[model samples]
Target: MTQPSDYREHLMAAALFIAGRRWPVFPLRPGGKRPALHGEASCPRTGPCADGHRKWEERATTDPDRVRRAWSAGAFNIGLATGPAGLLVIDLDVPKDNTDAPDGAANFRALCERHGQPVPTTRTVRTAGGGTHLYFTAPASCRLHNTAGKLAPLVDTRAWGGYVVAAGSVIGGLPYETVGPALVHPLPGWLQFLLIPPHPVVRARAAAALRNAPAYARAALCNEEENVRNAPVGCRNATLLRAARALGRLVASGDLSRSAVETALRRAGQTAGLRDYECRSTITSALNWSIAHNSGRGAA
Candidate 1:
């Protein structure tokens, strides 16, 4: 039998399935039943841990029939993983029409308004037949853990609350739809760029490199990759788009070598007075702390 400690790791890791990369942090569900699974039938109203250790029946294939049923009924998201105490969900909510974007637009708008941040230009995306997805170009900081307590409230699906961030990966939910591009706040663009990388070196390099690329593509590259494909896009700036672009330009223009770009990025990070290095270091410490203090529960 797996010890409670082992189960704890499994639970957190599983919860992260939805919240880990670009998903919201799985907030605590109400009634002490853990977070509710999105899209799937709500957990039987009894409570959490009614069973010694809540466990989900392993499925060879999550029912595609369920997904079809969900889409027809206007489900915005689907459940990715579920167990006795908790579940992970992703957006599958489809758009109402070609122009009607996914629920992500509404969600992001709501989140930004709540936070007093300016709303960005948005578009609807259709993922699979599941539903439309709204894309937002906020900041890379948006993807990290909900540090400001802004995300938890939005995602909080207290048992009685009757609201849920739809769960499930694109694969589980029949398929995700592409509504359009997510909204991007009309900032100086530099703000959006700088907030991207938690890495100092990458941030500096990307900052310098982006100077020469097409402005629209540069911004789109930063926001589009994560919002659209959910791919990291770049290593430091959420992926390597800026760094790679800079290197490519350097190679083409013969202005600098790849090694020089790297060195400049590092130097820029240190002298640019950006906090990517500091923030990255802090997050690394927090991760280590989280690992060290395993509480045998879902989240610390």
Candidate 2:
């Protein structure tokens, strides 16, 4: 049996290995997802340490020295930050009742079939809970969202603003084991589209508006729309905000309904692969700014 000290050393080495790949990592409590730290009683602040280790998302770091120090303090599991690390992990959870139906994997396969592409083999981690974690590099313009059972029963995603317990981490004496190739693959474009579909209302209105526009105006609109669709990930939010502002102007000119313009810009933003929360916030903020400066014509 591996001694407790040996296990601690293994975790430290593993954490450094992941960090070497540019993935930000943090320490988790031994055998758990929680940050490896003393309880709130150890916190000196009267309220709480909002930026402490317990805040794994904020505390996750790629600094090798910090990782070394954290692991040296005690036995700790590894935690991988999803967003900042530019990763999207598909988590296939095993059913607790020991049923043989692998619904999650089945649905994932079905989704791949619909896209007419084979599932890419990537780094896969077998969870101590009998689940599997498939790692992929996030798409250029896309921000995948964390969802539970949305793709299929027992399937989950850890994306931006989330974290995953790293492979080689132990919980309750069971270590997460690597089950496949160690390389993370690029997410396929078709799958990216499905995962980040446009909002229905916005899609409908945008289509209708485009269909009714004059030919010359339609050409300009098409060009503008294409710019949003082709934006890169880092600029997607800003592109969407600009689109929203332009739409706000159209609304002020009585060329489009205020709600429709907002929805359409939001839909285009989402389809171009922006994070939903950030996309919506950008749309709202941009529209408000436009209205405030444009004589309150598109106020809503």
Candidate 3:
């Protein structure tokens, strides 16, 4: 049986090992995955925490001295900051319950088969719960973000704003084990295509009715659709709201049928990269408010 001290020593060494490979690692709770850092509210307003409560990702360090100092404090697990490390890890997970559906690995395999390509080997880790983590080097030009089941059923990707439990980290008495070579290859082109955000299809089938509306309504439709599609990442919801409210007047005045406007706007919202639920709720609420405020049965 390993002694507690010995386990901790090994974990410290493991932290140094990954740091040597340029992965910025932060401390997690010993034998668990949660970051062991102090929260923002508990800040003493001194040291590095003095400036602000830096998240584990912000504080994740590649410096050997810091790694040694942090690990010397406790038998903490390792949380590799994926974004800072320039990693894109595709996490293949097992089903939560007993089900006949294919597990993540099999589904990923099927995805590869459909593309007529083999799984690209990289730095892989077998997670504690029998899942697989395939590590790849993110492209220099593209900044990928984490996604849940975006690639395939049960297959997720962690990039910016996420971290993965590093090898030698223990969870539920099972250590995350490295199963593949150390070399991290460039992301496979096919996989990259799947991970990249789809370009907005400015004129999808649902937006076909945009052409069928009256000249004024068509002009409104085109202007609002362009606004939604061109809206920057942070301003998407607000732009959608404004677009919905602007078009809602035409809908209320009976110049445009409610169904046609709603349908076109929904399509426009989606192509703007808003999620389905966000599109529905924002459009519905804004349109309702505009209709309630505007009084007309036909165009003025």
Candidate 4:
């Protein structure tokens, strides 16, 4: 039986999202371009930043007051843009999604689960060439960049294939009409009032929040490949080895222990810090390749 589109049902669905712990922002206008956030300022045309990235950064900085205002306007459907590589777009009208008719809905859900992101509901767009849009909520304290950065690594979607719809957009995907306003997911209320200045307490809080991020996020951050590639060689070798070993063991036995894997990563980091250095991304690709190809090694 066809069910009626109840506004209340959506409101209720949004309410259930609160259980996911994401902070609410502005009303999300589903299936349309979202407006720029209130306090955002424009980035300078020049000076050490990518044009696109600079623009958004400027907006975020310039419109401090407006941004604060928007933060205060509390509601669901609002979302912050984030990515380890930077902000991205989700162009749903791409030829691939149309031609392949891929099981994006399932893939999206699985990716979310694998990354430890709370499961979000998946729906098919009712447009001419149907596409899919997945939705879920995370802790309000979770920064958009961390969330996106973490999710980006886990997803297998093609770049132009599945872009992230930016804020101020009504069309989530061509076929998938985003029901905004009450359905919006915003930043957490507590986060809005945070000072975010150079303070011990704030720093401590930030560290704690980062530590509490979903397992997938922590794993990605500590992944041997990413850490080694980004860090100095002598420092990252052991971690790289540990990461490779973990993936090898997981693929070979299909039995990966989360605690064990983290312990190895901690060892690698400690080994490096003793020499005084941290932060690595150089070996990320190699480690990823090793982990992915391990299972295929004798399959042919």
| lDDT value for model 3 | 0.84
For model 1, the stretches where C-alpha displacement exceeds 4 angstroms are 1-34, 37-63, 66-118, 123-134, 137-194, 200-300
Using all chains and alpha carbons, the TM-scores for the candidates as numbered come to 0.20, 0.62, 0.68, 0.28
In model 2, the clashing pairs are: 31-171
* lDDT per residue (tens digit) for residues 48-159 in model 1: 3344333332211133433333334332233322221132122224345655443543654565564456654443435444444333333333331111112321221111
Score candidate 1 by lDDT: 0.35
* lDDT (10s digit) by residue, model 3, range 117-212: 997899899999999999999988889999987667788998999999999887777889898597789999877766777344533443555556
lDDT of 2: 0.75
Q: TM-score of predicted model 3?
A: 0.68
The number of the candidate with the highest lDDT is: 3
Q: Which regions of candidate 2 deviate over 4 angstroms?
A: 37-54, 197-300
Looking at candidate 3, the ten consecutive residues that score lowest on lDDT are 198-207
Clashing pairs in 3: none
User: Model 4 over residues 185-212: C-alpha lDDT tens digits?
Assistant: 4322322222111236644554565465
Candidate 2, run of 10 with poorest lDDT:
45-54
